[model samples]
Target: MAFRSFGSVDLSPSECYDMLVNVVTPRPIALVSTVSADGMQNLAPFSYFQLGGTSPPSLMISPTLSPEGTEKDTLVNVSATREFVVNIVTREMVEEMNITSVRVGPTEDEWKLACFTPIASDIVRPPRVAESPVHLECTVFKIIRHGDGPSASNYVIGEVVRFHVDDAMLEGQMMLAEKLHTVGRLGGDNYIDTGVPERFRLARPSTPLSRQ
Candidate 1:
């Protein structure tokens, strides 16, 4: 079950997109919530987000261009306001979160259609989804737009201003991982729980090893 030739399976973007989602096991789903200049709320889900830093905290989210090659509302708002929230979707809210992923006009509020409560944020104008287990408020400091196509993505680097976590979900000073039960994206419509075994720490090698 291996491709020995490194360059043999030259995957097209479409093929890569499919295989990555399918074979990469599971990817973290970032159900991003943002607000436009006019205060209209927008919601979209992307598996392209990852934690970037710890000191003062930061997050990196990629908002890909739409099929028509224009910036999506999430990208425009992130660029204009330089702010957004990364809502962590759990098992309970999967359906509602998926509903928010439906494409709509910039003037529309996906929150309403999804029938979820939008609560006020502390430092950012964009609100957080009340149903989400965790919410991270962020202010964009950089945008890396890729490709020349109309639908090119913007790799946004955002600084965390505040983190909202449900008190009930915490066990003492640590987060109760089993209780969180976060959902992740797989290839196509498939998904897997963030149910990785236990957290383990591995010691770093004291000396660098020479390459063969």
Candidate 2:
């Protein structure tokens, strides 16, 4: 196979970002919702997200700096109140979630714009998305910043305080992935449907192998 390699230092931030997103296939989307101190709702979708750990059940979402070199609304709100909610996006909610991605003023209500019902959360000030299959109520653990200007990224790490799973999506104690119909991010204006019939399970090797 023929391949081309480019040095990281040789590419612009935008160039690197475009390439990286394509290389990192099928990233999970985090539909994060937060509330300002004055009770304004802010919701946005972030593909640069992951569950950080199991011990404390941490969730991390990285919001890249805006074109004007400012932090995103979700970052600002979480900084002020230190609380937020992660609503797992499903196939049915993708269109509404995309509506929330529109750049709007701080006073704007994304829930209303997206036509999503805001349900009262058990612990967080920010309401959970009623349509979402899973809700993770979190308290800010830490905000780690990287780089400056266009290359900047803010990593908001949160500890999951409460987890709400829809009854229909659960099979015994496990959440069925197919029933959830989760969607994932791809490069550019692309996404992947995880509930398709392509899923398979692999068991880890039973015997440990000796190091060469």
Candidate 3:
């Protein structure tokens, strides 16, 4: 007979979060910055973020409402300005990113608190992180709101109009994840980075799958 793990394990919320954090291998964390309606800035980190792009080159950041169904600062700002920047989180600035994760008043400058420099962008009033190895300047494409549910979160999508990168962070035409040392958010306050571990890649189809 084959043995099973779930058979003896309880899948409670806390346990599930712990397992997901530790077992997801690694997930890219997005340290997003946005400006509120009154011209105040807000910074927050989200693990529910990832690339949903190409063509127009888009990105997605989700700001989950609390149990009371109130929008987060990031979500509110993005909706108003229709613009924001998605800065990649790296191991070197992991501590700063964590500080930005704190939920505070819109007037509080997370950048000042975290000691990150702000650089002007071509198309957006909001700024990008000078310390980040890569920055994506985006204009809001759309926002999908969710009704009250177990895990409902506001999904904000943006079109990338600009991209910046540090020359040292790239190897030839490829991004060396190990060298970039990007960090990912785990369940709670925990995070992990590229361990310089073994890796592999699969072949890509030259033609669109839909045409095949």
Candidate 2, residue 197: lDDT: 33
lDDT of 2 by residue, 1-212 (tens): 99988999999878999999988978899999999989889999999999889789998998888877787889889999999999999888888888788777788777887899999999989999999989999999999899878548999999999999999878887987678888888787778878873433222222222211
After superposition on all CA atoms, how large is the RMSD of candidate 2? 11.4
Per-model TM-score, in order, reads 0.85, 0.90, 0.78
Question: Model 3: runs farther than 4 Å from truth?
Answer: 1-25, 149-151, 171-178, 195-212
In angstroms, give how far residue 17 of model 1 lies from its true place.
1.4
Model 1's alpha-carbon lDDT is 0.79
lDDT of 2 at 17: 90
Best by lDDT: 2
Return whichever of 1 and 2 wins on TM-score.
2
lDDT of residue 1 for candidate 3: 94
Model 2, position 203, has a per-residue lDDT of 25
lDDT per residue for candidate 1 within 84-172, as digits (tens), equals 99999887787887777777778767788789898999999988999998999999889998875654668999998898889988977
lDDT of 3 by residue, 75-179 (tens): 889999998988988777877777776556666677987799988878887888888889888999999977564346688988999988888867776776566
Per-model CA lDDT versus the true structure: 0.79, 0.85, 0.75
